[model samples]
Target: MGIVDSKGHLYLKEDPEVWIKNNPASRLALVTSFRLNLENGVEEIAESIGELTHLIHLVFRWCRSLKRVPNAITRLHKLEHLLFHSCSRLEELPANIGNLVSLTHLQLSHCEDIKFLPNSIVNLSKLTSLTLCHCVSLVELPANIGQLASLTHLKLSSCRNIKSLLMSVANLPNLTSLSLSSLSLSEIPYNLGDLKKSLTRLDLSYCNNIEFLPNNIANLSNLTSLSLICCNSLIELPSNLGQLKSLSYLELYYCNKIKSLPDSIKDLCSLDTLIINCCDSLTHLPINLNVLHLKLLNFCPRFLPNGLINLKYLRVNICSCSDESFVNWKDPYSLQHLAISSCFSHCNYILKVPASLNQFVNLQVLSLHYKKRFVELPANLVGLAHLCLLDIQHSSISCLPWSITKLRRLRHLMLPKDFRLETLSYELNISVIISVNERHVRKTWEELKTEIGQLPIPFGGEITNDAAQNPSIMSHPGYLWLKENPSQWIINNRNLLKLVRFLDLEYVELTDSIMQFSELTHLCLDIAADICLPDNYFVTFTRLTHLSLHFFSVGKHKSITHSLSKLSNLQTLHLHMHHSVLLANFNMPVSLKYLSLSYCNNMRPLYDSLEKLTNLKTLDLYSCV
Candidate 1:
């Protein structure tokens, strides 16, 4: 019986014995926003909820048999947002709760039986966002919490019996985001540089007994994000930390007794993202870091900061390096995304693919992970040419270089998901091909139309249908043919197709050359048999937006779920069905925002079409039964 609307909002999830039997002056005093969730047998909350009195947003979520919180809610004097998140058997919080006075946002996170806080909550005074994250029996705080005075965001992460902090929190002065992550602090408040002019985000991540750091913390200077993730007794880091200068993100993960980095950090210069993962005794890296996104995991830095040159995203993991460690790795040349993993699992390492990687002539994403002695790949990798995404995972690279079809802006080719191709370099004119050996596993649609009429045709002569209806030869910008007779070169180069991935082939009938590309935007198909795709077969691509379908059975497909709800610029949808499939009129695409379903079965008639997606933001379910 709670649903008020018309400006005076009010929402309450049933069961507090039916809204405490209503009648709070009938219209609940025009509640100005009040939300209450009663998780099962609610334990308490009805002081007639202070008769609403135009409550300015008050939420008590997941009551979990709530236990106390009714000091008549501090008499809601125009309360400005007070939340008891999770309410895990809430234990405290109403010692006058600062007498409301228009309190400005306060959330008791997880409230694990909160232990301390009501020191009159420092008289709120327009409190500006205070969240006690995971208050695990929170102990100590409120040593006059710096008299609140418009406190600006403070979240005591994980609380963990908070060990030290209250030096009156450097007298707040509008603290700008401070989270003592997973505290049990072993040192920090030496007046914390008195919140150097309103700190701008500082999270001592998982403070594993913080080792060193108070060199006035480089006097903040408007700190812009600094997180010492997994502190691990952080060895050192205050060597004037380049005096912050509006630092822009720095995360030293798993600290590991530091070991070096303070060469004044080459004067940060507004450093833009630097994460050194698992800092295994860091070993050098401060030669002139004009950082622009750099990540190194499991550490490895005998040398590689020849003045980065405004590096643009570089990631290296599980280092073992030694081809002269990238021969002094010099001049990043504005690297555009590069990732390397398992650098070379030692043991007489023989990986070799770094001929200085052609000096990144504007590389655009190249990732090679778990290189189990990576076998091969450098046929000058087609001289970069703005390479557009090439990923080789769990590699032992088995044949792929027919000069990789001379790249020419290759659009996404990710191989090695246990890839098993024994051959296919017959001057490969690639489109999307995956052959799972075992003598062509299962290809019988007339041997897949006689192997698509013996493939191989990109840029290899042939013109006349009046030069393919010349509009300057169909908007020339050649070089994207993807093979001979590939459905007549994909219907005369349908606007130079954009991204198509087909894996585990077999019985693949290209669907009229995939509806004539028409500016296709990423499509992946993995069908291994039981076809069924004709409900207007994707209704003319329509600028398709990322779709992946992998089905082995689903035989009598129900019009492909009504043509995936008439994709209106579909945004990422992946469906994998094998055998048991009854999407029961699935119907997705409310302009989907990433939806993944695997091995779906009954799924209770797809639960009201997944509640009409409502612009779904990631909903992944596997082995759905």
Candidate 2:
């Protein structure tokens, strides 16, 4: 007995001669954990799995289609990990869950439909991690939940509906990490008399309506990190916080109401990191603050606190008085990282960075963003040989000077999109420009890559490496290294030819594909408004398997029919059209497994003909007009 295809396909008729029978764990146990199945279309679990009590892990994460766990699951005494994360349809946990006291990890993240936890959960004293992240539908926790004294970690991030903790959390003496973002508690209870002594990290950010911290927070003493980044209404801190000798980090950015720091703070000489931003109205720092060697400092640059003398790093986007640099450092100290984000619009100052930075020979990273009409790199920048990243983005300057070539050690040089370079290596490829996120920025850079690759702007397209030879694209770090070498374009095509396993040609304007990327397995061509598959366009791409077409051809009623019968390995097809028709009958082969057509206007005939695809297992028709 096991689950398959949204039902319990009971293997009740197994031949008696068969000695080796399959079990629940036999269903792909290679993965340690898989969560979020909200769209799997599974309506229920079959009762057959009740007999597979030996299974140690059961995860039905985000199973929005399943309203309940099979009743037979309670017999799984060997279960060690259970996760039903984001299971919005799950309204309750099996009451017999208590019978499996061997459970050590439980996660019910984003289970918005659950109203309560089974009281039996109290029996899991061996639990190590419990997460109730975003359980917005939950109203209460089982009163006995706190009985699990062995609990070491608990997170209740975004449980907005919860009004109170079960009070049992205090009993879990070994608990170390706790996050209670957006809790509804009016006040933290002082009933513990002491904070959880073993607790090391605490996050109470965004609990805005709460007025006070428990007085016992200091007694725990072992706490190392505290985050209150957006507790805007917090007016006071418990005196106990000052005595936490182990605390290393404290954050209070946007807590605007508080104006002063407690004298108890002087006891935290061991503090290495502190952030107090957006407390715009209050000013001045305690004289004893000079003893701190803070690693980072963030605040309105115009209203810098006076006593931050040994600050190691500063991120100030304020306008400094004409040619003036603040003196909050002891001739450099640990000031190795600095970011001055904004330049004054009105003042025409000396435009000199502080002279003290000369003592900071160790400065390795500097970023100046969104500057006014400033031009040219600062003279001090060229000397910092150790500097690895320099970003002067969104500046009024239009071009970088030849002095930039001296930054031999620099790895990432970021500037505004309009900035241009003249005499740089012709072999440079924009693909080397790394992006923090894979979105429009990536496409913009890729478009630039294809642009820069096609014709090295301002330089002749004479690739030393002939395209006839295939070379490994990954061996070369910088495309510029291939200059004056004939084997360059060969390497370029080798790099781009089959390198893109996932193709995202959203708005590519090529009238015809010029090259064959035989290894391209997945293609996304949404927003390709006027693109039409060329005749015999994909004939050479034998490995093309998955294709997706979406949005951008609005009201055009474009006819898009193609012969992909050669794609014998095709597995999935996804289409999203505003108005289009199959120009010709699809020559889909037998390997196709999934097909989805979305937002297709006048698509009834196309689906009616899809019945010919007998091998198709999954068909999705959504938003089709």
Candidate 3:
């Protein structure tokens, strides 16, 4: 069962005679539970897996050409799980591997030339999770390694030249989680807290000259996650660092002479995520970091801890504090999410706007990236009517006011990235440009030549029906949706009067205003060559439910999914064509849950008709050849 194509990509081939005629000890008994992986391709199953020893997991991991492992697997004593992860040309191991004493789980991670191990593997004795991570030419072990006392999770991370990690393997008292990261070793063997009642999680990051840390590490206290990152000459913390009271994550990054911390660090009040990046001699923080109930607070500013007062997700990334020190609103009001980089990058020499920023009234999203020159906003930024999402990426913004089209509960207004608009208007404020120049500025120099210079640049960005029939904008609603989506005349004319429910003409090549939508529910037309679908093209789309047509070419519906199955509550469907244009020969409609087909390269293998849809959860077949 293999090679599935049409862009989804699947391979799976090999079949040594259907696994040697369905596992033959020469007999027949079949019911699922079968397993045999000769690790990698080719090797044609070592002369038929030595005749399938009642296989229940026999993986000759990466069996690279001939070389042993076939002492016929010591006659499989009902093998359980012997995975040789990374058989780096596996050098040795078939010393009858203790005859698979019903092996529980033994994975030789990295299996590099198998340096040594096999004191008959302590006769497995029903092994419980033993993985030699990176086995790295494995230096030494098996001093009865405490005889694996039913070990529980012992991962020796990057065990290179281990040096001497054998303190009799910590006497394995049912070990629970132990990792001596990059064991370059410099000393930690102080009876590592005697595995304090089964340690929880501890990683000695970059063990470099350890420098001291194990007075029984305050007796583990069921340690709840601790990493002394880059232990660079580690210098502090051990006045019983608050005795681990179930320490909720503590990562001391790049310990550069470790300045200070540990006024008993407020006894770990369930600390969330705290990444101390670039410790740069980390200056003081933690006067209990504003009552430390943090949910992800990444650090950089040489350690920020000034009255964080429980900062509610604020990323002031490296401060220089100058939008008058962020409007000086001190209360932080559990700030929802604010990103203030290097203090408003000279935001147009801000003269005002910090009317205490309405005390961040649970602000939703505000992004301002201004390097300087001019960006002073918020003159009653409409008192932030619960601002939805305004991203002013790098600013010098020329204009945007008409009370920003009266917020009307604004959803998303993201302009600023090359947002060079010469115009977008509703008589643009300044008191509507001084009341249209005190009434037409004395009979017009082209009537105050504004109105987006008489708008019109293809696809619904219209505005010039003699400037929307300007007898003072005869009830201008984009000049009645530009005479209701009709085209080709003056520069533009959008006369749809208010009611713009949802319209997104993606790659606007213009022309084909779908009868200019009468309260369009959702329409996104892309790469337009020519389009116009609303000659009642399927019952006036009674509140259409998302339709996106890409790479178009109209007037030839070889039967577009049987005419889009007549929209019957269409959820979301996007079709893209070109390359091998065929308006028909298709199958869709299970009331699409979300479908995407792009660049019809040659459209064949539709995954067996897209697995009968079944209210699909999402399917994207891009560049479909």
Top candidate when judged by lDDT against the true structure: 1
Q: Pick the candidate with the highest TM-score.
A: 2
- Whole-model Cα lDDT of every candidate shown, in order: 0.69, 0.58, 0.54
**Cα shift from native, residue 435, model 1 (Å):** 10
Error of model 2, residue 217, in angstroms: 1.1
Q: Model 1: which ten-residue window has the lowest total lDDT?
A: 474-483
Better-scoring candidate (TM-score), 1 or 3: 1
Model 3 bad stretches (over 4 Å): 1-133, 136-179, 182-187, 190-263, 266-273, 276-306, 309-581, 584-625
Better of 2 and 3 by TM-score: 2
Model 3 per-residue lDDT tens digits across residues 1-625 = 2322343222223433454565444331221123233435443334443454554454544444323456565566666666766666566676757777777777777776677776777667677777777778878777787677776766776667776677766677777777777767878778777777777787888777777786677787777788877878877767666777776677776777667766766665555545454444656566545343332122333344545555555544333333454443354565555654433333335422334555666666666554443343543456555656655555544234434545444455455422212233433322222111111111121232331132222345533335454322212223222222234422233443333433444454455445555655445555445544433353455555556666555344344445665666565666766654543345665666766666665455456566766876656565666
Pairs in steric clash, model 1: 457-483, 457-484
Residue 559 C-alpha lDDT in model 2: 31
Candidate 2, residues 1-625: lDDT per residue as tens digits? 3233333222322221121234335643332222224345666666655555555677775566778876677776777888876677778888878787678998988778888888888888678888898888888778776677888888887888888876667767788888887887666656543445778888888888777887888876788888886777788788656787888888776777777777677677557677766665446454445333342233434444555556666665434441444445334545567776443343353243444444556667777655553444543445565666666664544334334445566566566532322223334333334222111132323333332222122123222234324332111112121112223443445554444443444354543433444455555554556555556555555666666566655333233334555667666666666655544354566666766666667665666667667787656666666
- Give candidate 2's error at residue 151 in angstroms: 0.8
